[model samples]
Target: MAGCGAGEPGDVRLADGGTFRQVLGLEIPNFHPYRDQVAAVYSTLLYDSLVNVTPENKVVSGLAGKWSATTTSAEFTLRDDVTCSDGTPLRAADVANALNHQRDPALAPAAAAALATVPSFTADADDVTRTVKIRMAAPYSFIVRLLGTRPIVCPKGIAAPADFEKVSAGTGPYVLTGYTSGGPYRLEVRKGYHWGPDGARTDEPGVPAAIVLSVVPTPATAANQLIAGDVDAFYTPDPDSVRAPGPEVTKVEVPAVTGMASFNQRPGRVTGDPLVRRALLAAVDPGQAAAVATGGKGRPARGVMAPAAFCSGDTVSANRPAHDTAEAARLLDQAGWVPGADGVRVRDGKRLRLKIVTFATSAQLRATAEFLAGEWKKLGADAVVEEVTVMAFITVTQQSGDWELALGAGVTGSLPSDAVPFFSGPIPPRGRNAGAIDNAEYLRLIGQASALPDEASCPVWQQAEAALVKRADVVAVAETTAIWFARKTRFQVAADTTIVPTSIRLIRG
Candidate 1:
């Protein structure tokens, strides 16, 4: 009764008939596939993709029964019997429409950035054999496996976006039967739901007949609910102290990059100078920052992606700048920044001030910002911390130019390629390149990696990531983790917070 094992999910499933209750912390405003800005947990549960990748990176059938992919093109042979929640056939044309619709101007900045890797999608559908051939605008090597992150929307959703807010128009195992802004959202299992990751189905004994996503705003309360068997599963922050002492509960903790800082390298900015960026990095110790952010319980950062990302490796460790305050002061001095009367670094009448933009909700991030500010003061740099609302955080990162360094928030996804646009692409209002980075070496390496197949591109991707850290475009400072507690339900989670819908099965008392 200490804690759940950290090994892979076991085959020992518990069979029960009761509906599974999944506890959530925030209120989801939208159900549209890419439009849900807050979190895509709802979208993942109600939608199915063309293919699904296991935690081990095994490509499995979801909507497409068979497929072949190359650098420039892909052909998918869809299963003949797939149907939408509305009882309409999920034809090849429908899948094609979903892929093409990502180009819609209404797509969010984050979503638009994710799909920007492939310039254009031109699909030809053959209704007779349920086949769709897609020609890419550019060479993308991860074409087949990358579909796991893309949810295919039915025709019902591609045409009318608002219609799907109440009900799901996907070929997923469950349909959204009920919804409210605050409390409970219900999901009813679709009968004969056959297309799940790795052939998981609805009629299985342990599979819950229905799933209820109930909002429990407080983490401590959700932990209590899980222990009392009132809620089947919930993600809690401080799992060790909050969770009840019991044998039935299972816990899974996943480490993700946190307390990271990115500089705005636009023209005429203080941080735009490479020497200043390097000095700023040298002044602060990332190990201490990670400790403060994680409350002394965190891991060292490994790479640009989370620990579980498909192409993750030790891309950050070998490239980080060593912590040396003397070197930091020397670099600033070499860059013509002299100590002013007030002890702030100044050059040509402009002070070396770093405005760190961080969100208000996370106490961990706040603590990290305060710690770094104190360290920067020792090097004669003025560090200012600005706290804002969640929405304002998005606005500041995407549009506002008032910030020099963004604290504790960065791009996170299941794939390494997800960081492509954020790290190197068109600047804000045009793309998600919020930092206005222009690393030609990174761009060249990423382009080469993307045009090659799966594991073959890992070396190139690592080189691209190294280029970022070497230039101090971003710092991989510390790691943070999320822990999920479960009772009377069992599932496997791929190392990040993303819930694998097919892995859930209820426990029998």
Candidate 2:
């Protein structure tokens, strides 16, 4: 297979001149649409969003041709040429079904909660006009971008919510040709996909051919496979693995979603005390955590919002709360926590000890938690690290609120609404606010921000971020560096802000 130049489409002509083959390795745990763990990689390939983001972080057309908005509602003009993998033409009814499916508690509970603010969606179609009208419940500033991130469904394939767990059907670039519950999954191009300019084919050579994604948990095994030429790519959060000495491969690090320690601000935990939470924040050394987590390849974070775009370079007071062991101890003492004989703090006969749960699959997160435990000990706090599988952590923390603190990561494209669920409280129990945070002021601000227009929403988001930072419900620790290793040396990979794999096909000689 020969590599093509940038902007030029490459085709792998077969002996029969009918089919092509493009093979790549992907790390995915499962294919459930609602779960964010492994669904991101698969969703982009097998399903279509209403709008698409370019390498430059600009919004472009995806399933919707164009969109318009009023002060109270937004409407999208659907494209008629799009079709699902099952050979059904993508229509306004399909979009309506997908939105309604997301709202269904059984099909996608998490997504539905995040989008609870949406009162309703009405789809109106006109055969002569070749367009679909999507009327929202209220004027949503990020409606276009939100729809772009939504998963387009095939109404005929999924009649019930139970079907989502077993079936994968969408009108995206790729189709699920093969899938296994705990092993590898395969996707093939949906012939005549009409979403993109040249149709929705990923830029990889023979990409329209097939995409094979295998879940390899062990870093050593994944690295060995890449070296042995068994796979074309591998997903590992560690930057060192991509930079390690190797042959027949090249490494590329794109921006990825960030990880943070979200506090469950319920009445029972240590988080119930404001001073205790402040002390924990003051105790953490983000610089050290970043160094240990990514081997000095990660960026320290100051708030929930990433610094890439919304961060203002204005000179603020440098004396704001930061790493200070003495300050942390002082705050804990002020909050009536007394040090015990074991060197851990205790208050009201109960030790000021808490269990910090994090996903074991991510090497960076696990290491960061260990480092945090040691740092908290210096402040007379006993911090226990509990490493659990991604599913277990989600089930216990997000679903049951059984954990005190958990390590998590999320990627928000250039939209504020994308980050809403993380801070919004009224969103169902299992919503993104797994922290159990319920702040009336914060909720009001989020609602206000969502209703504002794009130009006016920026300041609203800035104010909301400031409120989150002041409350200390969740603290952003580091910005992840996505390292990608490629075997083809002749092509240059395009770098972008999106954590999702895009512009992979734009690799050129």
Candidate 3:
């Protein structure tokens, strides 16, 4: 047995004399399952969604062996042989308990809001059926995809819903062995785990043996760790970091989750002024911003829908807004904004100065904010970038709704349906619609799109997106780039459409 010292370079022998070691650089803001704003690195490793989007962006079966859905109801049949990390049988009751607990308003408000449409969930254990039934309020077509993509079932033995928050108890291949609520989180392979896709696991090989996640908030540190052979892989938003010279590393780029600056449309600050919002959009150079923010790794976004899918060819890239100081000045001038003695625009005795807040954790975002501030200044608008912690940033954006503008990212697994919450009215408190935009026409179109289940829905979504663009509630800056840098040449890693890493397998020589 050999012990490896901290910050040591090169290969070190393990206790069992295995020469292989894979280190992963994980940049995480927070890891709490419920309260934390960002998804925990451990969550992905410890919980298996009922369904998952494959490397090709197609939905595939996960924990639920098979499932069927009607217009208003859905059902899932559990695998008979699956067991939790503790060797507890994963019965239908366990799945039901997880859903029921999530549905409880007191226990989990976020999950409750997501599942509010579900009328009921019934589990049947008789005759070894292992069936879980769900009744929805309406024909929620996206429910199947949502359920398949992110349902983390809990065992029935957990006495309280709060127990789930502290315990990583699921029937996945990996189990939580250690966790720190807001920082580092770690997981280890669950021995004797029996539930994965057929051929996914072999009886002789057993589980992964160990899985660890180190939450390094700095991208530089993450990259350094990967290069030093401290981590097997890491996620980076800046393309430059991934492109930086490194040894035994590979980079894989996928469609990025969209990033934008949202304005709260409610009546209050300059954000409530349509002219100010439009001016802000016109003043931004999305192309240059993308180049700087993502190291030219991102594509300038034209509309709400990702350009890669469902985008109409007629939608011209030139029509995609960019930095035009002259146009921004004209718009501001038309809105009765006059340049004051300080070279800042003013309307009705109010300075055009605005506070632009973003997360301090993301270096790219901070740099983008500075770039935007300069661009906004050229248009006679005073802008300041306020860097805050992830939790505080989310709170201010959601609770006070006082932010003039926010630079952030939107994560979606599908089209149309995923875009619904961003524009729909009666917006979920603290939901993605930080803009608080209330357009009756846009809301109506969103409703119409949700009811539609085929290609026809594309136009409806496009129309709604165009309306949002016209309103300038939020400016779509860039399509996210999900790049995975791996050091191991023997392993194959594929990037999924959801920007998640998948199809990982060891290529034996």
Candidate 4:
């Protein structure tokens, strides 16, 4: 509300009944759902998964009309009415193929972790009972929820995986007609799309007929476009950058996201030293960081997940870094780091200089990095910020030699299993454990939680999460809320996700 200003309502309709324009903050570098978060958004447009989570956080059926799951296995029944945009009817083999494609060993451990619950899949080709049976290595209570987030590809696309860049073969409500990396993307609605989650139909009143994703990397630019009536909607984690939209615009907050800094704790890295890590964590203030990052439009994070998240709790409270420059200085001094003539800490002739790499996804992240650098400087540590492309950022996370810290965005699901890979998997460059964090206690707690039945594992999961923060593996910055502006358009963003075009509709004026 502080940043939004009044603006005139723009005409929402195109020549057709369902076409609308929107702006994306980053250029989609890839279309693979397992590749990156940006690609997941595009995947949602071109492909519907076996199921989906509603805005209310309810899990509903998608391609699979209904499903049943056990701890070690799950079965999905293919809906008879679903078909690819090319008119290929949904089949058990296609579902199996899609699952297998995701399970490919070539993918990064973090990306492939989406199917961790499923070790193998079997297709039941019976024409009367089309189903796919998934076998898990261990009992997982949230297998359905995990599979529901995966975007399914047709068998043809799976066979010719290279063609995904040029085309998409999915059974979603929209067809990808045109796409250019870092450019505009075009999608047309399926004429008779009726297989949306929970009985969603294409003819629904608010469902957009078509969507045009115009690439605009800057939040300020996107907000201007929306205010000028060139774009109907724009989603940004830093709403303050958008300034203010007029009274005609509707603003919504996407909850359960966090913007934090992960420390690379590899053996030789500066952050690997527990004393230095604790000192660094103690020097900064999350409340001030969130205020600077959001321009006072955000809140400091109390934990890794949002309050509504099933595993959400104040686990980070015990480890929440306190703002004490003196304590930070003391810790560094005790660790053999002494201030040089220039006031920068030096030990054994090596200066306490560190670099924090960031991607160009959020302007606030850049500002927050600068803020942290300034704070660190007060304690005699020289921290610098480096901005790069999303692809480069992903690459840097895997190659963690040069960076001591990295500023990034993270999201969590309703279940603890959804976050396991990020905090507990193999070390950096090997899995989603970007920090190369190897906490035996944390890993032990996760294992304990994994073996427990659903709803009963929340406490252990919370303990595991708290342990990571307590060790300063990641500095909790802010509880992220996606501030989205809609003008002459109405849309629903899933509880843990940003806007998916299929759920958008024009405001009838």
Which candidate achieves the best TM-score against the true structure?
A: 1
Over 4 Å off, model 4:
1-16, 34-37, 107-128, 256-258, 306-308, 359-363, 389-392, 412-415, 426-430
Candidate that beats the other on lDDT, 1 or 3, i.e. the better one: 1
Q: How do all the candidates rank in terms of lDDT, highest first?
A: 1, 4, 2, 3
Scored against the true structure, residue 451 in model 4 reaches a CA lDDT of 62
Estimate the TM-score of every prediction: 0.90, 0.83, 0.81, 0.89
Structure candidate 3, residue pairs in collision: 23-231, 23-232, 24-231, 24-232, 51-148, 256-480, 256-481
lDDT of 3 by residue, 1-509 (tens): 01112112233221321122333333344333433324433355566666655443345666778888754666887777777767777777677666656655565556554444333444333226877776655555455565545546455324553555545666666666665655355656655654553324423221235545666665677777778777756656555543383645656654554456777776677777777787778877767877767656676775555443432222224444456778888888988889999999888898887788887767677888888888888888878889987667777877777678877754333444555556543344635556677767677666666565435466776766666667776666666665555554222222223222122332221
Each prediction's Cα lDDT score?
Answer: 0.76, 0.61, 0.58, 0.72
Candidate 1 lDDT, tens digit per residue, 209-291? 78999987666678787777788888744343364647877777766777668899887789898898999888877777778
Candidates 1 and 4 compared by lDDT, better number: 1
Question: What is every candidate's alpha-carbon RMSD to the true fold?
Answer: 3.2, 4.6, 5.9, 3.8
Q: In candidate 3, what residue range of length 10 has the lowest lDDT sum?
A: 1-10
lDDT of 2 by residue, 145-252 (tens): 565457766775456534555456777766666767665677665555557522344444433255566666655566677677665565454555433636556665
* TM-score order of candidates, top first: 1, 4, 2, 3
Which scores greater on TM-score, model 1 or model 4? 1
